[model samples]
Target: MEIRQHEWLSASPHEGFEQMRLKSRPKEPSPSLTRVGANFYSSVKQQDYSASVWLRRKDKLEHSQQKCIVIFALVCCFAILVALIFSAVDIMGEDEDGLSEKNCQNKCRIALVENIPEGLNYSENAPFHLSLFQGWMNLLNMAKKSVDIVSSHWDLNHSHPSACQMKELGVIFYNCSCLVLDLQRIFALYSSLKFKNRVPLTWSKRLYGVYDNEKKLQLQLNETKSQAFVSNSPKLFCPKNRSFDIDAIY
Candidate 1:
């Protein structure tokens, strides 16, 4: 009965049963060799190929690589060899006491260079300040090369004030901008406010300690009220006071 029903489905296009059909496998499951085309491990070699030719091939490939590397190195060496030869020839040919040659040929020997700023020491013993000047003079006396100079502002002398007559010189000197001007203004204000007479004489020589060991001088100040004495050097003389102005020529 079952064979008869199945036979009818084969005769017809659709199977006789609803939503059901027999699936036909052409062959049953079985193990087979995978055919990835032969490599040494996978397939047997013919006798003509011989036992282990791969190692010899690998060695040949490495030898070719090493030969290529050597060729490349020789090419690099050749590339720089001409430049090295030229440099060596030039160095050997050069009569280098080049500095001495330059000095002699140019006839200008700038012997020493010092970065001495203006008014180096001119304080208590103002003569010490001109040591740079003295050294320069001595150098000039012995080996007189017209001195090299790099001055931005004009009149680079300070033994006397700057020699330029301009009112507003750049950066360094300005006639309106004087250090003494501030001091003058301050003194003027102090005098106008009558601070000198008005400030009480509270200070005396009562402070006592041995400040000077050699002279046996005592550090006595602001102790006694009546014995204080101030210096009387700067007496302001009328319009003549303008001589202190940095702009004053003479």
Candidate 2:
């Protein structure tokens, strides 16, 4: 029956059978697109998860870095504050080391040099204020040699009568700029040497260290005193006044 049907279709041109045959040949079904879509979705989900995890890690690291930076800034600020405080303290200490008010005024010795001539018949050319000019004139008469003076304050620019008088006295004046003005020390030194009777004891200033000339004189004096030590008796003997019994008596 199949051969007869084929022979008949060949003889008669059966278009319906041909069409039916073409229709019967099954069309290839599109490979399950859903499965591929699911796979693609899963891959996309994994990539999203990885990206999210990386973003979270990066955010955490950035936050930690921010915190660290804040802490570092605070530490640097604290260090700067400490350094400024120490620097201020150092400056204050340096300033304080110079002198004090109590020592400055107390150490000064105001010596009355000489009495001025009262009523010396002052003319327009010679105005003699006894109290002021007398001491200065005396100082001028006294300073015939080099005068080394040390004091807390000195105004060399001011041309006072005393300053002029000192210049006239043939004195090479060297004023010391120290914290305290100890005129008493110089006076005492002159007194010890008995030069007080001759020279005017009004020192214009005060000093700090022992100068070369003074140090040399002190050394020479020390040497002289050391030489005298040979003539003096040695202090090796014990006191005879400390009585002790011969035996075990207390």
Candidate 3:
């Protein structure tokens, strides 16, 4: 009896208890060195990747700003270049116009007439009237196309009556245009009966009359009236009875 009981007690065949003992034991399995190293490396790689991304973004921003600044500078330079070019062209055009006018003046021919009679003051000496008349006749003969005469006291000269003949000759023979800037008083006399008494047969057929309108004539007459007594000068005259058919050429 003793021998049989002691065999089971000394070596109990319980595999479950051994398994439970192994499972319940304090297991202090430290993490693998390789695994920890891999984790640390991954974290560093993630940090490096994030830093590189930030640097790339910053570089892109800087590059865009530089491009904008360069573009602006180029535009400004182009504008300045265009302005300078236009200015140069305008200056060259003005210079060309001025040179053309100077050349025209230089090409003009001049005539020199000698043997001018001495002591021939037409204003004071009545004996020089023939010379003055001859000189004016010569000038009128020289005109081929047109003549312009400006006179303040045309009626005072006795030789001015010959001017009508010259004007008729210029208009009929040479088909020339003649313009006379006669004073208002002298013009009135020429248009009135005084002209017929002075020259009965020498009035020009192609003669044209031009004058200011009636309103302007009235105002000028008023001004003349106000100043006539103070100066005692020639009285102004407006063509009251003349025709208004011609165009206003004043």
| Regions more than 4 Å wrong, model 1 | 1-53, 78-85, 91-250
- Alpha-carbon lDDT, every model: 0.35, 0.42, 0.42
Candidate 2 on 164-201: residue-level lDDT in tens? 34422222112221221223333333344354344333
Task: Put down candidate 1 lDDT per residue, 186-215, tens digits, no spaces.
Answer: 344334435455432221111111111122
Candidate 3, residues 1-250: lDDT per residue as tens digits?
A: 8877777666565656788889999986567977898899999999999999999999999999999999999999999988666633434431211322123221112122222244423455432222344545677888777554534465645454444334221111121111121122234344453445343332221121222333221111212321100011122222332233332332
Models ranked on TM-score? 2, 3, 1
TM for every model, in the order presented, reads 0.20, 0.31, 0.29
Reference-based lDDT, residue 177, model 3:
15
Task: For model 3, state the Cα shift of residue 147 in Å.
Answer: 21
Off by over 4 Å in 2: 1-31, 90-250
Query: What is residue 19's positional error in candidate 1, in angstroms?
Result: 73
Which residue pairs come into collision in candidate 3? none
Q: Better model by TM-score, 1 or 3?
A: 3
Model 1 Cα shift for residue 116 (angstroms): 18
- Which residue pairs collide in model 1, if any? 204-223, 204-224, 205-224, 206-223, 207-220
Indicate the TM-score of model 1: 0.20
What 10-residue stretch in candidate 1 is worst by lDDT?
Answer: 203-212
What is candidate 3's local distance difference test score?
0.42
Lowest lDDT sum, 10 consecutive residues, model 2, at 226-235
